[model samples]
Target: MRAEFFIKSFCRIENGQVMFNGNTIFTTESEIFSNFSKETYRHFEISYPKFFKMDNLSKLAFLAAEIILKNENLDADKNNIALVFSNRASSLDTDRKHQKSIENSGSIFPSPAVFVYTLPNICLGEISIRHRLYSENSFFIFEKFNAEHLQLYAHNLLRTKKAEKVLCGWVEFDGDDYKAFLYLVEKNAEIPHTVQKIESLYYNE
Candidate 1:
C-alpha cells in the first residue's frame, strides 16, 4: 500500500508582508526586499548573524522556511526532513550583482562572497544550515510554479521512507520583486498533499 502525505502547515511572503497558515505575521512599508527581510528578521528575533550576508533569494527562502518550520515540532524529525524548492528566477537577482562586479570595464573585480550564491541551490544550503536539516535537498527551475511536480516528488520521498517530512515550496526573487510559499509535508495533517490542494494554497489570498 502507498503511504499518504499531508500538508501540515505553510507560509507566504510577498509585497512587504508575511503570512503563516493564512494569518498575517509581519508587515513592513519597505518595498525593497533587502530592507523588508531585515525588518522581518528583527521582528521574529531570529538570532542568525549570517542572515544579513545572504543574497535576496536565500534571505526570502530562509525566512519563509524559518517561519513554517519553527511553528512545527520538527526537533525529532530535523534530520529526516527533506527540502524541495522551486523558483522561476533561479539566482538571477544575485547573478545580476555578480555580473555587475565583473562587467564594469574600469574595475574588473569579482567578489567571492557574491559569486558564491550564483546558483539557486545556495538558498537550500542557507535553510539547511539555519534549521540544521540534514536530509535530501533539491532545487528546480521552472517557468512557473509546478505544483504537480512538487506534489509527486514529495509523495515519492515520503512513500519511500526517504524522509519523514518534506519542506517544499516555490520561492522566486528578481530585482525588487519576490514571492515565497513554503509548506511542510508529513504523514499527518488536515489536507492531503495533492497538486490541486497545493495550487489552491499557493494562490490563496
Candidate 2:
C-alpha cells in the first residue's frame, strides 16, 4: 500500500493579510499589492535584500514560501523537496510592465530587470533559489486552480521517491489583483493531502 501524505504546513497571502496554517499571523490594511507585500516582508523581518527587486508574482510566491519555511530550518544542500506551482495569469502582470517599458517611445530601451520576470516559472525559480531546494520543480498555468491535478502531481512525486516532501499551490498576480496559497506535503502530518482538503483550504472552507 502507498503511504499516505499530509499537508505539513500551509500559507495563504491575499487581500492584504497573511495566514499560516489557518491562523492570521499578519495583517495589513494596504490594498496595493506592492505595498502590502513590502510591508509584510518588513513585518516578518525576512532577510532577503533581493526580495525588493522581484516582480509582484515572485513577491507573492516568495512571501508565502517564506512564511512556511522560516521554521523549517531549511538545508542549504537539501534536494528532497519538490515544487509544483500553478497560476492563472502566467506572469501577465509583469509582462505588462515589460511591454510598457518596451513601448515607451521616450525611453531608449526596455528595462532588463523587469524583462527577466516575463515568464511565470520565474517565480518558482525565485522560491527554489531562496529555499536552496534543488529538486524537481514545475510551474503550470490553468484557467483556474486545479486541485485534483495538484494532488495527483504531489502524490506521484512522494510515492515514486522523487521527493520526500512537496511544496505545491497557486500563486497569481495579474495587474492589480493578486493571491497566493502554498502548502507543504509530507507523510504523518495533520491534514490529508486530497482534492477536497485542497479546495477547502484554497476556498477557505
TM-scores for all predictions? 0.94, 0.95
Candidate No. with top TM-score = 2
| Superposition TM-score, candidate 1 onto the true structure | 0.94
Which runs in model 1 stand beyond 4 Å of their true positions? 1-3, 76-78, 105-109
User: What digit string (tens of lDDT, one per residue) describes model 2 on residues 1-205?
Assistant: 4438899999998888999999999998998888898899999988999999999899999999888888788778765789999989998988888878878845645698998998999988998888888889999999999999999999999899999999999998887788899999998788988889999999999
Report the C-alpha lDDT of model 1 over 55-142, residue by residue, as the tens digit: 8899999999989878866674446889999998899988888889888734555688998999999999998887788889999999
User: Which lDDT value does model 1 have at 109?
Assistant: 55
Which residue pairs show collisions in model 2?
Answer: none
**What TM-score would you give candidate 2 relative to the actual structure?**
0.95
Q: Give per-residue lDDT, candidate 1, residue 128.
A: 87
- Candidate 2 Cα outliers beyond 4 Å, as residue runs: 1-3, 105-109
